[model samples]
Target chain A: MKARIKVTLKPGVLDPQGKAIQNALGALGFDGVNDVRQGKYIEVDVAGMSEEQARTEVERMCRDLLANTVIENYTYELAP
Target chain B: MKARIKVTLKPGVLDPQGKAIQNALGALGFDGVNDVRQGKYIEVDVAGMSEEQARTEVERMCRDLLANTVIENYTYELAP
Candidate 1:
């Protein structure tokens, strides 16, 4: 099974990278750009687990290691 | 409008970061992990554009600056 995880900064968290991107975009003449936030996407392949089990395990993985729960939020989907 | 962009490495590209993460996971005792790929997620806020316009502009952003077209693929969605 394959699991995809998206980890994003919680709203109100400072995102310097996002700010840098926004500025870079502005310098590139994409002037309409406003607030920007950057995050992470992770795809993991797992074996010996049903789809549900994979989802559960990956969720645990996110909570325990993949995401910094204090300032980030994560959501994931699983596929066969 | 707000847009979410996901950029991922093209298949067949060697991913040292992914390999490192996989090894780290194994060391952390999350044993079933197989192939792991890491990517970037970006959220952008734009003004003076309709949903369609936002999508078009963000797609261009991906092509020109957000993603390296030679080795990465990007997809995005826009929301009001």
Candidate 2:
């Protein structure tokens, strides 16, 4: 089993890093790069578990340490 | 159109940030947290563009700023 976790800043949040990337993209000649937001991804191997167990484990991971709820939110894809 | 980009450090790579999180989770009573990896997430509005165009745009963004290919890899989900 494997899982892919995505963590992102919620909407309406300020993303200075993203803004910097947006500007850099425009300077690099990649036109129509209308917007850019920065985020993180985590991939893990869930060797033993059902979908329910995996989800519960992942949710705990997110809330406890994987994410800073004050500034980030997360979602994950788990494949058995 | 909109997209979600997830960035993560490749496996076999040390993740100090993740280790820190894992420790925190354990301290907080989140048992069974075998591991934790930290990453970033970005969600953006793609107002207009086909999937191909958006992908090209995103790849450039990842290369230029969103991700440091030397140590990170990224994947994205786009919904039109």
Candidate 3:
């Protein structure tokens, strides 16, 4: 199974990297961009695990390592 | 409009960050993990643009600033 995860900063958290990108876009002449937020997208391949097991495992991974729970949020999807 | 973009390394690219994550997961006792790849997820808010225009503008932003075309590929979705 494959799991795709997205970890993003929670609302009201400061995102300096996202702000840099937005400013760069403005310098590049792209207008009307009100905001930008950047996050991590992770794809994991698991062997010998059912969908339910993979979901549980991946969720733990997110909580333990992939995200800082105090400042970020994570979501994921699994596929065969 | 809102644009959600995923920028990922192309196939055959070496992802050291992903390898590190996989190793960390293994050390953390999460077994059966075959592989892991990491990417970027970006959300952009565009003001006063229709779907078609937003799509075009976002594509340009991806090509010009968000993605390194030599080794990265990007995909995006737009929502009102």
lDDT accuracy of residue A79 in candidate 1: 84
Interface RMSD of each: 0.9, 3.2, 0.5
DockQ of each: 0.85, 0.46, 0.94
Please identify model 2 stretches exceeding 4 Å from their true place. A1-3, A43-54, A68-72
Q: Candidates sorted by TM-score, descending order?
A: 3, 1, 2
Q: Which ten residues in a row have the lowest lDDT in candidate 3 chain A?
A: A49-58
Q: What fraction of the native alpha-carbon contacts across the interface, defined at 8 angstroms, is recovered by model 3?
A: 0.93
What are the per-residue Cα lDDT tens digits for candidate 2 across A1-80? Answer: 66678777887899898887767767877666566777766765554577898788778877876778898878888876
Tens digit of per-residue lDDT, candidate 3, span B47-78? 99889999999999999999999999999999
Compute the interface RMSD for candidate 3: 0.5
Per-model chain B TM-scores are 0.96, 0.90, 0.98
TM-score of each: 0.95, 0.75, 0.99
lDDT of 1 by residue, B14-77 (tens): 9998898898888888878989999999999999977787877898899989999999999888
Worst 10 residues of 2 chain A by lDDT: A39-48
Docking level of model 3 = high
> What lDDT tens digits, residue by residue, belong to model 2 across residues B1-80?
67777778888889998787667767877555566677777766665678998887777777777778999888888887
Inter-residue clash pairs, candidate 2: A39-B40, A39-B41, A40-B39, A40-B40, A40-B41, A41-B7
